[model samples]
Target chain A: MKKRLFTPGPTPVPEEVMLRMAAPIIHHRNPEFMEILARVHENLRYLFQTTQPVVALSCSGTGGMEAAVSSLFGEGDKVITVNAGKFGERWTELVQLYTGSSTEETLPWGSAITPERLKQLLKEHPDAKGICLTHSETSTGTASDIKTLSAVIREHSEALVLVDGITAIGAHEFHFDDWGIDICITGSQKGLMMPPGLALVAISERAQERINEPARKPSNYYLSLKKALESHAGDDTPFTPAVSLVIGLDEALTMIRSEGIEHVWKRHESLAAACRAGCIALGMKIFSSSPSFAVTPVWLPEGADWTEFNDALKHDNGITVAAGQDAFKGKIFRISHLGYYDELDMLTVIGAIERAMKAIGLPLTPGTGVTAVQKAFLGK
Target chain B: MKKRLFTPGPTPVPEEVMLRMAAPIIHHRNPEFMEILARVHENLRYLFQTTQPVVALSCSGTGGMEAAVSSLFGEGDKVITVNAGKFGERWTELVQLYTGSSTEETLPWGSAITPERLKQLLKEHPDAKGICLTHSETSTGTASDIKTLSAVIREHSEALVLVDGITAIGAHEFHFDDWGIDICITGSQKGLMMPPGLALVAISERAQERINEPARKPSNYYLSLKKALESHAGDDTPFTPAVSLVIGLDEALTMIRSEGIEHVWKRHESLAAACRAGCIALGMKIFSSSPSFAVTPVWLPEGADWTEFNDALKHDNGITVAAGQDAFKGKIFRISHLGYYDELDMLTVIGAIERAMKAIGLPLTPGTGVTAVQKAFLGK
Candidate 1:
């Protein structure tokens, strides 16, 4: 069977990137690798739209999130977390771990946190050390208005704004400097179009000042932003980096650079639009109110079994999409338009989904979704 | 030029493993990946010589070391660290970060920690929370007697024995269960013959008890062993795993299983002996007093510039080895016999070193090191 990946992350890696990784591994300490790392940092800054050099760690995006939390705030510090989905809940969980006090400004899953609510939360927690939110919530396929939230933070609070841009950075509109984000964290498997391993963290000057504070002691060696940033300044990694992943990312980032980040975002937007149109045309409701360009979610049709539907989509049609996570499981399914994807890929996915839905005895015509996809793509 | 990677950690990966990783990316949440993770965990136990399922983290070996430290002990805890080389120094740094106080048992670079010294340290620090040491100090290519040291610790005090087996696990003899080790950590790039990304941590029942202590609130989130161990029990990962690396590691571990881990250690030992013989035949002194089977450190010939020597070896001969780290930089160069290495590979490396030496105008028989490598391998 020709297996296809449609998950938000671990997306289809460009063959070039995979081949780059497949080559012999390079030593982190090697000057050759140092040049590659330097290039990757520069390109990552462009992707994050920042002037500061990004700190790349040899861990997943969750590690990057923890690094931001553990490094920026001290124990018992007051923080605010936006909990709209699983990823947001993670931010809340991590914030609670370090900070003894945290205000979880949460909404129902698949719902967006509004600027007014964020402003209210900021006003409520006057002593907030930081505000952690997801730029694009991967679990619920929800995208938040980060620019507006950042503006509100600037207006109402002295809290540092940390954004989990894991699924958003290159896929959505992100301006680190313009929006005044203290830190933006991302992973390789999503917008970077590479396999999972490396976590790139872009930090603003404000974040660096906090990191350099005399009293700041990140309770970690590997995830220490102080150590990572210092080494990155010297174009070196603090520890043994995931060299193959880094090398592949260099090529992947080059692809992003070649397409331009704006184009990457535009492509994601187009794919998401087409995917959502197809879902609606098939009479399925969209899951998230604020649909993310990275991924789209749709509620299952009435009487549709998730296992049978998924088996047809995955086993029969060779397409693998994600099911709803946690409490929402078995109710909704997701399709990613994140990385290394195009209009054709979305059409293929929707076409496959249509077949799966039909196989599961859902009231659907074969060409209905596919024609909707073409119409949406052509309209865009 | 055909590039050769010989640094200790990011060693050469097997072609099969690289090919597996080069395949289309698989979602970490996929059942296929779960099966791969289970297989990896089981085989990691075989590699570590233990019955426990190893906790795999999406970070470097240093991350694994820190995870063990931050998870097992707490704030103001008194921990003991062995500082022999760079990696050992990392252990000291990490311990000092979490533990208010730490006793560093110091040894010169290229020297091993004696079992008697460990016993004495254990006696002195009878109130120590835990003791952290490197099974093989990667910087100076020195291997310690972990079995004897564990026995000493077993007889002495109640400190947990945590070993950084990054360079030593598959290359050197290890017995996680029989040696009474509490926690042993290794990475994929070492003797597992894969790229850098995954950190495999094998924990004993004794260590789990400490981790599960009701009062234990590890000052970490991403590096938390409690979550990792819990997830591993369900054949899952705590966070997004480095799926390609894990998939590649699954194949790499399968290779080790085919040959047997004992034979893996023996092969590394044989390669190290041949490398050491080649160094001696070239009339150069071996650097480490307790040279590891993973890597062999050799003192540069008198009046030879390190840069010129490395340039000739790396650029001219296309064989990339490592230079001495930290204070020993420029004083010596190191050759790795770590992973995916065999007799012919050793001969190729030694032959390149000989040619490189000749290019640098060293007085030597052309085939001296090569002949020695061949003789050593045949003798073994």
Candidate 2:
């Protein structure tokens, strides 16, 4: 049963990328692997929209987040994180682990962070060392305005602006250089459409120096940015890397390049819009007020059974959609539109939801949802 | 061009195993993955010759080593490491990072520690919390007498006995239960015939209790044994694991299990004996006084051009052997007989070396090495 993955991460791997991963394992120190590493670095920099040297570490997105917190701050340094969703809370947790003091501007699950609030928080904590936020909050299906947030940070403080672009990188319009993101961290599993292993961290010269400062204690050996950059320059890792996954990533990056970054971002935006439009046509309300292009958080009808809807989608229709996390669980379901998705995949998913809703006597419009998505995709 | 990898690790990955790796990735949270992880654990126990839980981590063998050091010992606890080879020296380094206090038993490269000397060291440092050593060190191809060393440690103190069995676990006989090893660590690339990214660690209940103690300073989080075990119980990782490599490892373990453990060890021993006999017939001195079954370290004949020998083996015969590390660079070469290899593979690698030596105008014996290897393997 080859069911397609509509999840935000561990996305459907392209056949070409999967075959590339299956290639014979080469020594990391070998020249052939070195060439691949060099290309991957160049491609990552291009995709991140930064001229900065992006240090590649063999860990996950959370590891990169941990590295940012551990490397940049000391025990008493003040930091602020925008807590819009789960990933935002993760930033606060990591910051607390490294720097004993931190603050959070808590937004409701479906709500986005307003730039006015960000500026106010920065003013409140003028001594803060840095600010952290997620580009796409997968748990809430919302995206914070990085361009607006970074501009606010630039105006108020010289603190580093760290962005967790784990779920948004290839799917959203992010310019690390133009957006003034000091530390941009992402994972391979998300929009990169590769199995998780490599965590990509693009660090500016400022962040690098901040990492080397005497006050900042050594974060970790494996996740050490200093160690990763030293070995990355020579096209090797300080530790044994996930070799096969690196190969898959090289191929995935090539595909992204071939498709063109702007076109890929446009595809994601359009896909998400179509899914939303389909839901609206079915007389369903979106769980997220400010939805991102990565995923669509949908609310079940009043007193409707989420377990039944999810079971019908997965077991009967062979479609797997994620339920909400934390407090949102059982109240809502998420449909992802990120990575290796097309109009037909979205239509099939929407069709399943329509049929399942009608079966449960939820009073959905007949074929209206599927046709709306198809027409939206076709620009009709 | 085809190449035979004679490096101690990443020894040859069999074609079937590579194909197994090419299989599509499965969701780690799914039942399919649970079955795979469960079977992998069972097979790992078989490999380690222990009934204890053998945990699989999504990092290199070094990660497992770090996990053992960080989770078991505290900031001020004293540990003893036998520095007999490069890997043994690594234990000393890791101990410094985790425990902050360590005593070393330094032995020369290509040398093994005597059980009596270890006992003497333990007597001097009876309060030490742990004793760590490499069962087989790949850098110099020296195999330690782990059974005897464990006995000596047991006699002196209640300290845990840890073994770095990275190169020894499958190729060399390691009775984790019988030898009373509290912790044994191995990697997938060597002896297991899989790529890097998976590390195996079998822990005794005593070691588990030490790790579970909350008072132990958290030296590291990603490599923490407690965190890993907590996640493993639910068929998930604390982080996104190296998915494809785990799939490859499952296949490799299946192959190893199909060939009984005792038979696998004997095959390695026999192949190693043949390699040693062939090297002697070629008039080369063995580097290690007590060589390991995993790799044979051979000192080049006096006045032999090291550059010419290494280059010719690679360029002319497409055989890639490992050069000696550190001070032994250009002084010795290592031929590995571990992982997805047999008599034919050994013949090919040794034959290449013989031809390369003759090409360099250093040896007089033609077909002498091959004949000896064949005779030993035939045992007639």
Candidate 3:
């Protein structure tokens, strides 16, 4: 089978990067790996759009969020987490678990948290120590306007802003320093065009200062930012790192740099627009009102069997789109154009979804979705 | 230069496994990856020689140790850590950092913890909540008799036995269930013949019960074994695991099962003996009295410059051996036979060392070390 990936994360790795990682393993302590680490450090900062150090952790994107909560927030510290999707809910869970307290600013899964509502939440909880939210929520295919939201927080409280940029950094337009984000986390599989297992965390100076606060002792050791920072200063990791992933990350970052960050964002924007147009042409409603460029979710028809449609897409067309998670499971299918994606890739997926929908007896005109995708992709 | 690896942790990975990993990555949530995970789970138990579940975490070995401490031990719990070398020192650090109370049973770096001494320590710390130690300390090339030490702890104290088996499990003889060990952690790069990202932790029934105790709240979310075990029942992980690494591990474990665990141990034993004999012929003192079969450390000649010798070995012979860590740095060199090593490989490394020693102006017979390695490998 041809096996095409349209999952949010683990989208697709470049073949060159995969081959580079498969070369014989190198010693972490050796000079060669240290040189690689140095390049990875500099290049990762470029990817995050930050001047402050970005530490690469050997875990999933969720671990990066865990590190932020455990390292910066002390016991009983009040924080605000926006719950619009699964990842946003994770922030609430992690902050509540670590700090024993959190104030939630929640919305429907497909709804975005506006700066106005965030301002009201900050007004209610004026003493919040931190503000946590996901820039792009994978499960809901929604993206919060972090720049405006961070500006609102800056006007209201001194709360440090933490953003989960897992599906946002490479695909979405981000200005970490300009937007005043204290901490931002991204996963390798999403924006970095590598396999899972490595997470890059960008910490601003204010967040580092909060982490070093005497009152906020590090409750967790494995994901401690203080230790990572100290080691990262020397281009080394606190523990043995995921070396092959980091090496792959270097190549990935280099590819991103060569493509130009603005062009990367433009490509994602075009692909996302095409996907939404194609789904609309298929008579399927887009799931999110505030959709992210990383993924596009479409509602299943009223009587369509999700399993049968999924089988047609996966088995027949070799296309694997992500099934909805949490409350939306088996209700919607998500198509990702997150990494290493182009206009033709988006058109191919739309064609597959169209075929699958027709196979499941869902009302759809032949060539409608593909034609819409072509028109959108070509800006006609 | 054609390169060879002899690092204690990151020993060479098989070409077949590397090629498998290099193939386009499959989605971790897919049925294909699930089948691979199932096979990995079964083979991992066989490698650990335990009936209990072995959970894989997406981090280095230190993260695995952190998981054990945070999951199984409560705050202010009294624990005892034995410090014989670098890894043992890490145990002291981790336990102290987590529990804030640890009694030390210190030994010289190269000395093993005898059964009598361990018994005395257990008797003194009878109220200890946990007993933490390392099976093989890589820094000083020391290996403790874990079976005897566990027996002593079982007899004298009710404390849980936690073992860091990073460089010990596949190379040395281990009886996890029979030894009454509560927790044992190892990394993929060590005796597992894989890369460095994944860590496998074997947890016994008692340890799982300890984790379930009302007072033992998990302080960590990322490395939480409780979450891991719950997910493991369904043949899944709580987080996006290192998918490529798991697939590679599946193949690596299959190779181990084919070789038979006893033969694997015997191969390591043979390589260790050969390495020790070759070093002896070079008039170098073995660094440890109770050295591990995983790696052998040898003292450098009085006038030999460590950097020059290393350069000769690496640049001239394409053999990369580990430099001594901690207090022994610049004084000794370490040669690892932990994973994927044969007697011929041992002889090749010995020849490299002899040539390097000669390059550094140290007096040595050219073929003496190789001859000794051949004799010891043949058990003559």
Best by TM-score: 3
Better of 1 and 2 by lDDT: 1
Clashes per candidate (backbone, < 3 Å): 0, 0, 0
Q: Model 2: per-residue lDDT, tens digit, A35-96?
A: 99899989999899989888777667887888778778767888998898888998988887
Ranking by TM-score: 3, 1, 2
Which residues of candidate 1, in runs, are more than 4 Å off?
Answer: none
Deviation in Å, model 2, residue B4 alpha carbon: 2.0
Candidate DockQ scores, in order: 0.83, 0.54, 0.81
What is the C-alpha lDDT profile of model 3 across A1-380, one tens digit per residue? 78899999787999999999999999898889999999999988888788999999999999999998989987788999989888989999899889887888888989998888888888888889999988999999998899899999988899999999999999999988999999999999997889999989999999988888776666878899999999999999998898888888889988999999989989998899999999898888999999999998888866778899899999999999999888898898899999999888988998998888888888878899999999996667
Minimum summed lDDT over a 10-residue window in model 3 chain A is located at: A213-222
Error of 3 at A259 (Å): 0.4
Where in model 2 is the C-alpha error above 4 Å?
Answer: A214-217, A301-303, A358-361
- Give me the iRMSD of candidate 1, please: 1.1
B311-364: candidate 3 lDDT, tens digit per residue: 999999999999998888999889999988888999889999989988888998
Report interface Cα RMSD per prediction. Answer: 1.1, 1.9, 1.0
The CA lDDT at B269 in model 3 is 84
